[model samples]
Target: MANTTSAKKAVRKIARRTAVNKSRRSRVRNFVRKVEEAIASGDKAAAETAFRAAQPELMRAATKGVLHRNTASRKVSRLAQRVKAVGA
Candidate 1:
């Protein structure tokens, strides 16, 4: 119900932003999932590699405003710990 022209334009912008954010969020989740799957498979080297890939994706998501900085950092820290534990 955007009656004003500016309001309509704003709605359109929001829709586009929503789609982009959705894709970004999905990409982040997929990256995290890859790391988790590698960890679950008990392949230390593969898990480490996946973690390396995921860490940057998580931070990039935060930089793009898809995730909070602390949240991203926390996830990276926890995943790193899990990856480390895999070898031990």
Candidate 2:
């Protein structure tokens, strides 16, 4: 459908970016899931550790434009709260 050479190149670039973004999003979800699973298992130490790992990943995703900054911060805040509650 793209008749122009530039448009064709743009379509290719978009496809590559889409793949990269999808991978990044999936990675973020996997990190979050790890934290949640640790929390659900009621292992405070593991939950805290997982939260530590996930927090950076979330922020990195935001930095990479995979997520909004506020969304990442909100997720970090909520997960931190849950991690704290796990110890209590």
Question: Highest TM-score among the candidates is held by which one?
Answer: 1
Predicted candidate 2 versus true structure: per-residue lDDT over 14-41, tens digit per residue: 9999999999999999999999999999
Task: Report backbone clashes per prediction.
Answer: 0, 0
The TM-score of predicted model 2 comes to 0.98
Please give, for residues 1-84, the per-residue lDDT of candidate 1 as tens digits.
Answer: 999999999999999999999999999999999999999999999999999999999999999999999999999999999999
Candidate 2 deviant stretches above 4 angstroms? none
Query: Which structure among the candidates has the greatest lDDT?
Result: 1
- lDDT at position 32, candidate 1: 97
Model 2 residue 15 distance off true place after TM-score fit, in angstroms: 0.4
